[model samples]
Target: MKASLETLEQHFATVIAANELSHAYLFVGATNSGKMTLAQWIAQRLFCTNVKDGQPCGECAECRRIEEGNNPDYLVIQRATRTIGVDEIRGLKQELSKSGLEGRQRVFVIQDADKMTPAAANSLLKFLEEPASQVVIILTTTRLARILPTIQSRLQIVTLQSPTLATREQAIQQLGVDSTFSHVLSTTQFSLEDIQGWLEQVDAVQLQQTFWRWLTQILARKDSAFTLVQTQILSTFKEQKLQQLLPDLLLAALSDLFTVKFALNRPLNWTNQQENLQQFANQFSTQQVTALLEIVLGLRSMQEANVSFQNVLEYTTLRLLVVLA
Candidate 1:
């Protein structure tokens, strides 16, 4: 559904028109890049009773049921926890072994396929090895490296591009947030679901402004910057509230600042805050900004590894101070 996936859509149309649909496919892309949406569209196309020009007619009963998640022939498997267990893969194999309930073909979509446990991934590899005649398997993931190589070898991998700023703005508006907040969120590589969850907990506009103010203080070598980190970032927000997301927001802002400072040709993610970014960019040397960006980026991996958020923030502040000095 994302505007950025036009090329991918055309490719699928061509494949269907040629009657060359693959048995197994891997959809790899950044989060919120429409991998799942494209997978669903492909499933609809395969299941639609009224297909026109290699695309689903959308008005067909089968297409409507698929859209409503009530299609008997279409199955979606997702991780209920941090990892997909081996049992889930076994269950999928069982489902695939049976005949299609309503249609001639069966489609299975596995979301976050990279989150499969090693055993689960091995099991999936075995399943993928034996192709069913009337079945299609589509796996979607933001982290392609985590998937097994044997499994990857069996799939026809399709890479997806990130959505444009304008497309993201429209999505944000539809989520019931002010469109201006997209200026802050669009800079970061977050999925639509991730953005919606964050917005539900806090005002994204205010959070963006607060991060900008904190970064400005750090750039100016103000003692209050550390104070803000301790009080606002660490003490006030708590780990559950802002730990993982704050680092990403900071990184996004710093990246924009670095681009502005170097007069890069790429578009700024925070277009609405151009004046503040320009001012901040003027205060830092290229080396200092680059160092800070690297530090912030590392924080993302650390956060994922279950590092202490407070320690990470304090260390980040110290590192920024050292870079600025």
Candidate 2:
């Protein structure tokens, strides 16, 4: 669920009323944290002829056009092929200079602005310094440090955080999922639709079977069999899919170890494998579970370092096996 930023919304409306809104705004936040949604809201409010209470009325012709992505004044600059290059920035400059097609301002929403290449960043600097009077540039990125300082300097920063758990639950309920699925979905900061789509594609039964087999093989010190599992995941699942699932799996493994230590409610995600987890959980102390979580976090960093996924899982499994032994 998108957390409404009432303060920011009011600030935006005041800025608009004063005709002093910044030419560029950099929205910094994690993925799916409502940055994009908030940006669109602000754009709609700025362009809407009949705004109310710092929010867009959502009934006017401008709002409808923007909602449908057909507003001539709205320009979205997303990565065309995983990178925003200088060529794209140059073309945007040409477009920004033109008159607004149908509204007060030409809104340029740059999604994943962190993907901008060095050349593109430099090209964007010129526009930021001398932005067109009737142009609004909204840049959204998860990695603010990657953006050039010059670019950051020309923009006001809008920070968005993950929504609260209660809000997330309400959102899940609105999507018509049961309480059990909602509990699992709460582990992430995604919307209900996003979670449902991911779960629909995940084939969790197959993953659980493979994961259980892998864990058993590790306990038995079957390096060859574990290597095969690693290779299979690398070849079959997309990199992003593995990245998402592995974190949840790591968290579940840590929780299982803890539950075994303290005899708490069975570990959340892997509760179905309680018997197997319990066998080792009783053998390990709570400190060991904490240490295991630390190791998993380090492995997560390795994955983010762009190391091959196969290497990460292989190295991670070996380390865990050694620690358990």
User: Best-fitting candidate, measured by lDDT?
Assistant: 1
* lDDT to native, each model: 0.79, 0.72
TM-score (all chains, Cα) for each model: 0.79, 0.75
The model with the greatest TM-score is 1
Worst 10 residues of 2 by lDDT: 234-243
lDDT of 2: 0.72
- For 1-325, candidate 2 gives per-residue lDDT tens digits of 2235666677778887788887889998765677777778877887787887767899998888888888878888865355788898999999999988764678899998987888999999988998788888999987789899989988988887767766776777566655544555566534455556655666545555566676666645567645765565555455465455665666666666676668775435554566777777766767666767777778766865678777788887787777666
| Model 1 residue 40 lDDT score | 85
Model 2, which residues run further than 4 Å from truth?
1-3, 29-33, 52-55, 79-87, 97-99, 117-123, 142-150, 169-184, 189-193, 212-225, 228-239, 255-278, 285-291
Per-residue lDDT tens digits for candidate 1, residues 162-269, read: 767678778877887665566666655566776677677776656766776777788777768877877776543552635656776677678888889999998776
Q: How does residue 16 of candidate 1 score in lDDT? A: 81
Cα-lDDT of candidate 1: 0.79
